[model samples]
Target chain A: MTNENNSLAEKKTPPIYPVKTKVQVSIIFFVILGIYLFSMFWTQKEMVGGFSGAFENMFTVMEKFFPPNFGVIGAIWGPLVETIQMAIIATTIAAILTVPLAVLAARNVTTFKPLYYTTRTVLNILRTIPDLVLAVIFVGLFGIGLFPGILALVVFSLGILAKLISETIEAVDMNPLEAMRASGGNVYQVIWYALVPQVLPQFTSLVLYVFEINIRASVVLGFVGAGGIGLILNQQLGFYNYPNAMMIIVLIFAVVIIIEYISTKLREALI
Target chain B: METYSLPPKPKNSLYKKLKMIIITLLVIALYVWTFVSIDIDWGRAIERAANNFQRVIPKLFSPDWTATGEVALSMLETVFIAFAGSLMAAILAVPLAFLAAHNMMGGKIFSTIGKWILSAVRAFPDLILAILFVVAVGPNAFAGVLAIAIGSTGMLGKMFSEIIESIDMEVVQAMEANGANKIQILFYAVMPQIIPEFLSFAIYRFEVDIRASSILGIVGAGGIGTMIIFASNNRNWNEMGTILLAIIIVVTIIDFASSRIRNKIV
Candidate 1:
């Protein structure tokens, strides 16, 4: 009877707050805060030479990009088209290649654990390096041209497209695949009739996403003399031809918006 | 149920069809044409790559351990820049995301404006933004951080808004049905479901930010990337090799750690 009364009293009491855990969390936040403050001061000191002068001249620099030169539009059209084409070609090639690579990489599809991991690791490392860096290296290897840009895009987009598509494959219904296998369907047939149907929408959407990224990346690649509007933009910037640079920037902005809108709509429709 | 019987399958494959054959041939021809147009000189490229490897391979093995201190200091800045930038973006993105969510905003105008802002910011690649900021902010790490923050806001806002749109509306409705205010409902109901996704995306963005910050130094925004470009310009392969080694090590370590954290969060 006394034990039962004590248990009832214990249940009625409110639980105490964990003050130590709160303190620990606070300590972590403070430490991070301190580090951030220290880095800010250090960077400020290091950048002393050019730092203050930049802000002072900001107004003058802003003047240059204004009232963008509309006349330079015609001149940039060809290179702009070249840039779009490069992206299209790269996206197509990468999308096709990614299919086989993605299939071989997906753990459920491949069943070869080691091969799956190795391919996945390759894709991860490939994705880490910036597309611009790849273009720069390829340009050095192959000489300055569009070829290097396309190659870089192919390699870069392949990494992204493969990873995304492989994940989609992993998320697919396993029952359908099992049924296909039980019926003695070959690997190709299983993929075509069962796996492909399930993942096709995601694949197309991912391809389009990669294409958008490739377009932006290709423009930058052109800056390193890889042959696109970026090459022209870089030249103008190099010569301090602000008017021409302004025009290129405007055109780029417009093109990017249109492409993004179209791709976004398509993706929405697919999904 | 009645069982249906079919005729025996054809011996020939689907590729034997005239339309399929034509389509395949056309695709191959188009690819070949693009390949040729791109002017990829396989032989010359192979030779040059071989020569580059010969120069790079030996130097890549050796790192300047003494310079590790300086590199570490710079790396701290890179990390802080990424952290601070993403934090800033996360803070800014919350309100923008709320406004951008169609279900929440109940108006197309605001969402359209939000989306336009996002796309405009995104259209200018981080590299270009870094360049512009470097020019504006004087080649400082502050510029790097701010540029990343501005660019990141675009992506974060878009993604966060989408996450909001996809959330189960019942929970939100329940909160609204109660005496809770907008802020209270947001905090108590909408946030819990979206927190994991938000954290996952933020951490992934941080990883990208690290890589982005590394490259910003190339445009004079200040980091070890400046060292790589310097070494490259001076033809100091040994120094470049050391920088590359440092980068590969640091990046790989961070990449591993962040993904682990992200995995736990999601």
Candidate 2:
């Protein structure tokens, strides 16, 4: 009986993690660690005094930004409004343009495989390009002004809005659409009667979300000479006017928080 | 045919009608203000496009193959900055995530403070942070890494906390009933549930960090953006073309690989 019990215990004992999984996890962990070590070494090579020196200088450097000049608030108000206007204009244009592109990209709505695939591919490629890069190019083309900034924002927001709205289109309940088709409705009539109502709330929510992103983006577009509060901020920093830069930064932070709060409330009410 | 008019359209309440009219009027006023206030030099823009369009568009297509090596090196630096930054953020966010997670924290106040800190950190764009770090660190790849690290931490912390909150608590309770200590319960019950998602989100953040770090160079924080600014200033469209190509290819590849890994991990 003792021998039989010993054999049963030996046979029943199992490892907490399968041997294969253990090996894989360890290997992955080590590989990631190795990559991280290499990256740190490479990046640190370019530093003048490395992390230690930077840490020592950080406090003193930060001190230069304090006692922010509230005087600039009056000066910056104009560009601040320009920044907000840029976002609003871009969001509006993008929202209107996204409808058709979204429909073409949605597989269930478009149904034509070639058209859907082409639109999807174009949008994917478009998204891969950073908004800053787009702004830079348009500034080159349009000679550094609000036009380039607005154009960049419009293009950037279009990619995101189309992708989001298309996904919402794809997930809609098909029963109503099918019923409309059965009632002898044409394609346009069916889409208008069945699809629009279902997607309107979500579309509005997504557009609001994109508008928040646009607001953040438009603030930075001025860095590349695209025109807005960022242009003034950049100039102040260039002049080594840390106090004014600090003021601008504070203003940007407050505006961003306020706008985001309002947009979030609107989206919550929407969806 | 029976002279039966369609059922009378339902009348909206007075409040609803007023609300609709107010919204419409506000929208129209907004557009009117925007168009009138925005100062656009359409004439200059049209003129510039006519002259520069031919010169720029052609060169953009025919990239300077000679600049590929320089562009590739800078692109590699951008990747390294992103990787190091994202990894640091992943580790740094752990304690904050636990602090913010309502279930993990002992007091609601701590969680609320944690949440506020995360959002505040998130409010500053990576570029803005890069500018500050560049001043402190004297404009190097390390500055880029620091900016990316801090910028990513806010997002990662929030996501990790959400993951923690969504975890099944019954297992933790069972561990407690079995006389397990806090540390034991965390390791044996909680970590197993959250680890996969944490790693997945960290990897995804790495992808975003790459794109972000690429532009940090604009402020001299280090990466491809420095090259871009130089190229644009000199009107070197061919070089800009190569840089653009490199960004698109690298971003696309990283996004693909990261998504695949995230799928497997989660």
Candidate 3:
């Protein structure tokens, strides 16, 4: 009995986590904590009154935006409609342009390794630049109008749509495509017959999703003089007409919510 | 040759046909309305592009090396703002997530309210939030931090609640069977299940916040965007080029690192 007990005691029990893993996890946790602390310190240094004071200031600032002037709604209607139109045009253009780019980028579809890689790289670079920056650049070139705003939204949405659609394409059933190829169909025929039917619903859903994003983006594009309700809002704010700015903000909120609701419903029906 | 009878053609439902036709017409009308309503000075745009294309395009390609230090410093501030804001949001979102998670909350009312609050927060773009906070906090880096924190909280809270809802309840049931209290069950079973995903999402939000914070400086909230605005105002395309390069490199690196870390965690 004593010998058996000794052997049992000598047996190694498995741990919930290995010692090495525990050490690594602890080190990582500490590193993250350290970074967070340093960041808090650095950012707080620039604040005049710190967090408490800022909170106090926020309440006072909030008071200025209350009782939004409904009087500006009639005046702002034209620009508001323009914003929606800009989003619609951009989304339509992007959806149309995304097909070729998405196909080229999808590894399973393109087959040619260099072409796939080149398209992928270009899309990746394009996605890194923010929509507003694109708008600013386009506005600089085009001299401030709805055209630049639409162009910016198109480029921005194109990058995102291409990436998403390519992923969807890559995940598709290749068997049908292979069967079409084996039946002596050309590349376009195979894609049209086999691939299109499979991806159409998802493609429509993603386009609606991108449209929702474009609506939100187009609203802000006006800040850079790219033409939209945002330009009016910026002007109102500059003129210290908080009531008008508040009204515009409220209208934007309403339009955004309504459009998103409609888009979401449409997307649900599609997918 | 014997004549074979052709099979009957498949007929679409009347409702489906009408729906398709109506949708098509609506789309066409929308396009027509858009084209007619939009006012574009095509001649001006064309002339401006022609002249600016030569000047701006070339300068944008050749970056100003002299502004490297300033850009790097601003970029670092951008990172710091993102980190601080994301951490704040990660912590702040926990209660909201719990409130929003139907499995965790006792009634539908609180969860619905929680969800509404989150969506409301999400509707405002980060730039607009930054603008508000700049006014509130006197136009500093702190405002950017506040904006990012609030903006990220909306998304993080929503994601975290979804994660909570999807968690396995068997562990909680087992803990309850062992006579564990609500708090005990939550700490022992619930926290262990959701912590990894929560951390992963928080880190991912940090990646997004970095991109967001980089541009907040345009409103004087503080980041590389201030330099961008100044550069553009000064028409210093070379400086703009350098700033753009810095943003791209930083954003890409952060995205890569965050994704790697998130993959490891989740």
Candidate 4:
């Protein structure tokens, strides 16, 4: 075995790619220097107003945000609850819609080139626009309310959920899909029996993941006068009601963290 | 006699049932909490629906044509913010990722700390991070850029570490066996394998950052989102429409360019 290995090694030399040390170092130096210079130039010279001004203002800002009013939390409770419901409803709708969309988009499942490409392109375009932008547009059309928020969530989550679920679908055990097809099952039956079972865990996980993102995004949407906690938060900020804003921020942070923890645990189980 | 060999039904069925019930209740609680928080009035909502429809319909089909130039400039700012932010993230994440990788650091305490920091960073969404930075530094395009950088580092670090972890161990082993030092092993064995994936992910993140940067403007971080807010608030549907067009154009172009580049690299 040793003799054979030696002979093989001798017959076929391993490919070698030379590394140029000095050229690489110079390139790295130039890139770093360029970035530093660019950022320095871009930051407004007058706007920064040095460290002293920033330091003096910091105390004032902190003072305003102090003694967060817990009372406001209960008042905003209803809106906060609505925000989550919006996310839940939208996520559920998107998750259900994403099933057919994702299956159609998955290259392996769809088979036909044009249909696959078209579905993927649509998803890509959908994903290119941010959720906030979607909300802004929807709010313009629908007028500011929970409806706009929900519509935005549906579109936004559809983009992500579809892309993720399709990828999962593509990665599933193909042999089962083929076996079902071989057994004379129709397209729906094949997908149902084979692809659905294999990708269910990942699909559910992705849906939950999108839900988390949607919750956070909905808050931002609310800031733009679309109905939610963000709308109230924006109003407080506008009014310079820093204490109230601080309360909302704190509550949001706590809720976000808790939800993330639970979702993470659930995702682990699902996957 | 053969029945004795049959497998006993799974034990702890009661416990499983209890766990299921608990989970279902939690889901319900979560739903209830959200509903209560958002203050939805179904009756009022239904009443306002038609009025909303009347106000918004005219603006949908006919966008304002005049604000196209300003929209274009804002779009550029958005792209600039994303690019600059992602560039910073890519630069910063490289060393941090190397440090965070388990095998690279050889079970060092510093690596564990680095991993923890990255995870914490990843836990917060880019938008929330932007809000924090806007508060810290004052709201501006600069804050937006910094926010994207901070958020992107978390993701890029996570991906880079995973990439490093998945690299063929034999290559590094061979380099070590040949008396190559740590740096040599990194350059010669590790980087070549993961460079393509790293670049692709970075570009993908950049595309996402572009969209995010545009939205960050709504929070006073400078971008097209500011114009979007202005147009909407002023009830200038034409201006809003123009901005939307510009946004669509910019996004489509970037999306196409990035995908092409990613395909080439990966």
Q: In lDDT terms, which candidate is top?
A: 2
Please name the candidate that would achieve the greatest DockQ relative to the true structure. 2
Give the CA lDDT, 0 to 100, for residue B99 in model 3: 95
lDDT of 2 by residue, A43-109 (tens): 8887888788999889888899988999989999999999999999999999999999999999997
Model 1, runs deviating above 4 Å: A1-21, A47-57, B1-3, B6-53, B56-73, B168-172, B191-196
What is the interface RMSD, in angstroms, for predicted model 4? Answer: 3.3
- How well does candidate 3 reproduce the true complex, by DockQ? 0.66
Between 3 and 4, whose lDDT is larger?
Answer: 3
User: Of all true interface contacts, what fraction is found in model 1?
Assistant: 0.42
Off by over 4 Å in 2: A1-13, B1-21
- Which scores better on DockQ, 1 or 2? 2
Which RMSD values do the candidates have, in order? 6.4, 3.5, 4.0, 6.2
Best by TM-score: 2
Winner on DockQ between 2 and 3 is 2
What are the lDDT figures for the candidates, one per model? 0.78, 0.92, 0.89, 0.79
**Per-residue lDDT over A1-271 for candidate 1, one digit per residue giving the tens place of the 0 to 100 score:** 8679768977997644388867876996698678767756766665655546767776677786677888888889978888877988889989889988998888887898899889998887777766765665566556677777888999989988999999999899989888999989998898788988999999989998998998888776776566678888878877877777878877877888889888889799889
Error of 1 at A231 (Å): 2.6
Q: For model 3, state the Cα shift of residue A35 in Å.
A: 1.9
Each model's TM-score? 0.84, 0.94, 0.93, 0.82
The structural similarity of chain B in model 3 to the true chain B, as TM-score, is 0.93
Q: Write the per-residue lDDT of candidate 4 for residues B184-238, one digit (tens) a residue.
A: 8878898889988998998888887888888888887777878878877887776
The whole-model C-alpha lDDT of candidate 1 against the native structure comes to 0.78
Measured with C-alpha atoms, the lDDT of residue B101 in candidate 4 is 86
TM-score of chain B of each: 0.82, 0.92, 0.93, 0.87
